[model samples]
Target chain A: DVKVTQSSRYLVKRTGEKVFLECVQDMDHENMFWYRQDPGLGLRLIYFSYDVKMKEKGDIPEGYSVSREKKERFSLILESASTNQTSMYLCASSPSDSSYEQYFGPGTRLTVT
Target chain B: AQSVTQLDSQVPVFEEAPVELRCNYSSSVSVYLFWYVQYPNQGLQLLLKYLSGSTLVKGINGFEAEFNKSQTSFHLRKPSVHISDTAEYFCAVTEGNSGYSTLTFGKGTMLLVSP
Candidate 1:
């Protein structure tokens, strides 16, 4: 079975601290994505990586960055954690083609204080 | 650019009642539509998708959605809902025939099924 796993289920960080959220997929997919889910706002894409070392900014990429050193792992980074950044973060993976559905990780709930 | 809109924020219904969750989209070109369900505290799961050919698509858990190109809508419906079906549903769209699978999602609708 295809599976996606996030490094942490919950995290807490102080303002100005740097935070990392990791995601790994066993499906060997070429496309990976990071999104933040907020009440009323839904899930907004933060960043997506199409290949190793290749990344693109999404609609809401202002306060976030991503890294993909390997095909199966994608990481979302917060340079400076802030209260506004507190939300549930989701990671997903799909094959290179657009026809396949994205497989998602359980999610990481981050609390910024 | 493509965008999606989920008409209702929340819908409350009794168990075994029929339910409809509306979704609309705005895109200049052809698009692929999808419905995803997010259970409490978990990740999103694909409920169904409308890629091509058939206007009506059936999905897992006895749910289905119809694609209306002229109306620019893809509404999700189920004949009967169980209490276990309570969750948030999202509508998403991506430009069809594109090399990438990046999607634009709706704000989502919360389905509260009561016994």
Candidate 2:
């Protein structure tokens, strides 16, 4: 079985604070993704990394950045958190060749006040 | 670009009753379709996927989905549902040609199963 682990299950941060959400996968998948899920808005992609240090912006990448210094770890960074940034953040990973199947980590519910 | 649309935002059903969750997608090229179920406070898990060969794909938990290319739809169905089946179901699509594995998800359909 594939295991994806997130650093935090829940988090709270004040406005204008910096936040980081970490995700690690034991499968050594080459593709990692960050998504924010909201009611009625669905899971919108924030950022994705195909390889170490290689990142690409998704549909909604504003106010968010990603780091993939190693193959097993991917991190989501909020330069300065805002109330609007509060959401259920999800991390997923898949193989480089077979992208159809993705394994997801338990999400982190971030609350910004 | 690939996009997915879940027709119904919510579906209410009783235990041992049949249920169907509709999903539609749009993409110029051949695409891979997937249905995922998210239990309360849990991450999304793959329910089923239509990759190739077969149009009807069966997944875990007695859930199944059919991919209709002509209709551009991949609707999930279950013959008899249980209270444990209550969860948020999301439909997603990824273009076959796109080198990256970026998936476009539909606004999920929340399935509420009652006794």
Give the C-alpha miss distance for residue A11 in model 2, angstroms. Answer: 0.4
Scoring each candidate complex against the real one, what DockQ results?
0.72, 0.72
Q: For candidate 2, write residues B51-113 as lDDT tens digits.
A: 898899999999999999999999999999999999999999998564567889999999999
Clashing pairs in 2: none
Q: What are the chain B TM-scores of all models?
A: 0.97, 0.96
Worst 10-residue lDDT window for candidate 1 chain A reads A94-103
Q: Which tens-of-lDDT digit does each residue in A65-105 have in candidate 1?
A: 99999999999999999999999999999997757588899
Model 1: runs farther than 4 Å from truth?
none
On residues B1-115, what C-alpha lDDT tens digit does candidate 1 reach at each position?
7899999999999999999999999999998999999999899999999989999999999999999999999999999999999999999998856455698999999999999
What shift in Å separates residue A87 of candidate 2 from its native position after superposition? 0.5
Model 2 lDDT on a 0 to 1 scale: 0.93
- Each candidate's interface RMSD (Å, one decimal) is 1.3, 1.4
- Residues A1-113 of candidate 2: C-alpha lDDT, one tens digit per residue: 99999999999999999899999999978889999999999899999998989999999999999999999999999999999999999999988785568899999999999
